[model samples]
Structures are given as C-alpha cells and as structure tokens.
Target: MNSTDSRASAYTTLSRDSVHEVEIKRSRFITYLFRVESEAQAREHIAALRKTHFDARHHCSAFILGPDRMIQRSNDDGEPSGTAGIPMLEALAKRDTGHGTDLSDVLAVCVRYFGGIKLGAGGLVRAYSDSVSQALEHSTLHVRQRLRIFTLPAPHALAARWENELRAAGYQLEPSVWEAAHAVLHIGIDDTEHDAGQLAAFTAALTSGAGRLQPFDTKWVDLP
Candidate 1:
C-alpha cells in the first residue's frame, strides 16, 4: 500500500537519521535508524549502507512505514531465520513513544561484522533486538500532527493587527497571502471540534462579526 494511503491522525517518527553500534562477543552490530516515508526510500537507504559497509558480513534490515504502519518488512540477509530481522522489526513496532503512539516511518538496519564467535539463534535475536532498541533510545523522536487549514480574509491593517494577537493566543498561522483589497491569513489547528469552535468564535469576535473562516484541506505538521 502507498505510504499516504490510510494514515493516522497523529503518529510518532524519528527526528533524524542516526547510527548506533554495539559489540557482542567481539562482533560489531551497527544499527542505522532513518525516518522514511516509503518502501523505496528504506530500500535505497539499505542499499547505500550495504555499499558503504561492503566488508560487513551481513546487513539485516527492517522497516515500518506509513502513519498507520501498513507496510512492515524485514530481511535476515543470511542470518539465522527469525533471529535478526524479526527481532529488529519487533523492536520498532513495540517501541514506547512515551505518548502511547505507535512508531512508524522508521527503518532499522543492523550490519554485522563477524568476529569468529557466532551467536546462536536466541543470542542473535537478543543481539539484534538490543541493537535497534539501543539505537532508538539514542535517536530523537517527534509527533506528526494532522491539522486542518482555515483562511480568514481581512483588511491588510486588520490582518497585521490581528496576526500578533492570534499568535499570542496560541494560534498557528501560516504565511499570509496578500491581495489588492485584503490579506488571507492561513491558520492551522487541530482537527477537533473544540479547536474549531474556539477558532471560529475568536475570529468572529476579532472582526466584530465581519470575519469568517474558510475551511481548507488538512495537512500533516511536525511537533516536538
């Protein structure tokens, strides 16, 4: 399925790409974490890593994409079956975002450099899982909020005066569009009944019943 296909209203994702390494039994497990929106991006990242770490023995990988997490994939890359990739994927799926939201749009790849001491099935699983878990612990994360857009048209002077007031009132305003007669202020707010009511009431009061909010499509915005 497409990454944008049945998205959640809000979700958690990595703030940036990160790499964390660990040593187990003399073998190096380097975990790369990337925020990805599609399977193709995840695959591209894995391929790049394989090229960068060409000497590594194995490059096991897993990815969870889409806000709804509808696309989940893992590859063992010659590691024992169900040991490396599955555990890595589970680490991402079961990650605690502290806000109770599921983690998505993330890809984890563990490149292993053999140290001649082999980890058995259980050991491999634990090692790979720990590799991703530790990497995630060090990686920064944030939430994506889907906000509804509203446009309020007003005279340029009034728009300028109200812009600061709106910001002070905690309203999220996008850049305004200016026309000959007026300015269109783009406002973004949570797609909730309470927020809608508050915005409509506030705008009406600000304009003394002359202003009206024009609803537009929703967009996803990032929040720390």
Candidate 2:
C-alpha cells in the first residue's frame, strides 16, 4: 500500500454498539457490536447478551482491542470449530473505518437461533461473516489520532470570535479559560499529520502574530 493508505489504516474504533440480523434458510443470525475498552468489558458484554438471548443456541464472538490494535480474541461459543468465531473475527479485521484506519476496541457477537435446519461448515462461515458485515453497515466509526494537546493564548476581546473561527477552520478546541488578561484556548493537533505549515500560517493570521501555541501533552483523540 502507498504511504497515504498505510497511514490511514492505522487505528479506528466503533462509536457505539450496533445490531443487525439476517436469515438464511430459516436459520437466524443476529449480529451485535459493542465498543469495549478492555477484555473485561468485552466479557461483560458477552455475558449480558447470553442472559438477554437465553434461548439462543450459539453466541459466537470476536474482539479486537487497544490503540495499537494489538489484542485479538475469538470464541466459537459451541458452534462448529472454526465455523463461526473465526469468520466473524476475519470480517472485523477486513473492515475499514473510512478514516484511513483499521477497526479496534470492538467486539462482535453472533447469536444463532436454530431454525430446524443445519448449515455445513462453509455455510456457517459465510453466515457468520455476512451477519457481522451487515451489522457494521449500521455502525458508526471514529478515527483515532495520536495528537499533541496545545494551549493557545488569545486576547480576551477576541476569544469568542477566535474560538468559532478556529473550530470552523477544522481545529479541535477545548473550552477557553480566562487567565489574567488572556483567554487560554485548549486545542489538539495531529503533530504527525501534514498540516504543520497550514496550521502555523492559520495561527499566525488568526492571532495577528501574537499567538503563542505550546504543546502540553500527547494523547490519542477520537474523531467522529
């Protein structure tokens, strides 16, 4: 892949849990998605679903976690070996969040309600993958960016205007705080992105050469 595509495929996660269902030959496959920050959360979600869908025959699941997308786990949950959870996991792995990143911190579970018919291994795989894919269609995605938190000092007189204008120009800003004579504007910038020159020029023009932007910390921010 090119550098642009490679960068875009870095990290992404689900904005919320989503649900979608499908039927094949009367066999019902209900796919559920959950946003989980850790393995404990994922396990809790799976347990909750087990209680809610008590009659479900199988509750196959898969999960991927961390900012680096380093953790992954899958469970067959009583389904035929390699037929349900593996396909569900692969389905999530193949998903693109459309923000140049792979999906993470999410779990997918497929609850199967037997419909008096049996699907072979291949059919089960297709059903599980397709069910998760369908659920992802209704899921919202968030982009995760490693960014530098900055404090920009603005004249109190221009604080409101600058807040509106800077945000409108695509800068993510936190609330402004009055400190003596200036309004300190908290903002975040993706230092690794190719917007340094543009951001510098914009800040200079906005503050009329008086803006002092300083980095406070580095963190990962989620963008919808």
Candidate 3:
C-alpha cells in the first residue's frame, strides 16, 4: 500500500479541570488524553489532574485502545452512568479507524470540574465528547507507518562501508557493533515503499549477492 493508505495516530489528554477556584469555559475543551501503556500510567494522569483541579466537582474519563481493545475502561466518577464514560468511550471508538490495527492496549480519561454549572445528561455527553474533540483539534497527530526490519550480517571489513551505503540510500540503520568476525546490522525500510528488486540490486552491488537479509516483524512506527 502507498503512504496515503497509511493510518494516522495521535497522543492526546482527556479533559479540563482545575482544583482551586477557577473559571471554566464551555468551549468544548476536552483534554484528549493519549495512549497509556498501563493502568498505572492512566491513574497517574488522573491523579495529576486531580491535584491540578482539586476543587473540581468531577473527573470523568474513558480509555479504549489496546490489544482487542483489551485496556478498554471508563469512569464516570460521580457523573450519571452513560453520561461521562459512555460518551467519552464513543468518542474514542470513533477515532479507532485512524489509529490502525494495533490501536488496542490504550486508555483515555476525561476529567471535568463542575464549573458550578450543571451540564444535564445531554449537555454532559456533549461536554465529554467535545473535550476530546477539542484536545484532538490542537494535538499533534502522527501517521503510523509499517516498517520492515532486516538483520544483515557482513564481515567486519565491509560492514562500515555497507552501513554508509545504506544510509546514503535513504535507509535507517541501527547501531552496528563488531562481533567475532562479522557485524550484525539492523536495517529498517518503509514497507509502503518496499521494493524487493531495488533491495536485491543494492545487495548484489554491496556483497556480490553473498549477503543475507532476514525479515523481521512489521510494526507501526512514528513518522517524523
């Protein structure tokens, strides 16, 4: 597939809340919290928000992204069921397509401080959803590109030259270190632009077709 066919991913925070007395705006400014590896990280975000807005009435949150959406979870805090969590979850689910296939194993939370204004169930839903939406609007999103890792082994004498050639050719090379009489090279190429013929030609020119390249797992990596 071409790069245009690639998916976009993002890192965002969940909500807006203040601990002390503060004015809250109703501009739909959800924090759009991002992917957290563990529940602990998710809680850390929650705790920090609480500390930041200690006097806020509620901190609603929802996180759904991970293996099988494995880490899916949401908290209404003190809000009515389906108001805070469900709306937040729905927002997350809507963004899943852009996140690619590995979007599972992620979490999100929306923290709301009452603002002394009661947002009814309908308003609450809009508020929660809008929070994420606003945050995403200002957030930096990245495209998740598929990369192919290859292990190339070459004699120490030719390793440095080979590495330089690959770099000059627009390939990313991992750190190469000497081991025994050979150097193991880790190379990454954008699968979307993968050209086996070009690779074979390069290898032929570099090692007279003697070098071996082993394929590794494909992964979603951040694009600059």
Clashing pairs in 1: none
Backbone clashes (count) for model 1: 0
- Candidate 2 deviant stretches above 4 angstroms: 1-10, 158-165, 205-210, 219-224
- Candidate 1 lDDT, 116-164, residue by residue in tens: 9988999999999999999999999999887889999989878898888
Off by over 4 Å in 1: 1-7
Candidates in order, TM-scores: namely 0.92, 0.83, 0.70
**Top-down lDDT ranking:** 1, 2, 3
* Decoy 3 TM-score against native: 0.70
Question: In model 2, where is the ten-residue run with the lowest total lDDT?
Answer: 1-10
Candidate with more favorable, higher TM-score: 2 or 3: 2
- Highest TM-score among the candidates is held by which one? 1
Whole-model Cα lDDT of every candidate shown, in order: 0.92, 0.85, 0.64
| Candidate 3, 1-224: lDDT as tens digits | 55554443233222232221212454223353555657778778878777876776677777765434555778888888888888777776676444353343345556554555676788877777766655555444444455667778999888989999999998887787679979988877766444545665687788887988777656656556
The candidate that achieves the highest lDDT relative to the unseen native structure: 1
RMSD of each: 3.3, 3.3, 5.5
lDDT of 2 at 46: 95
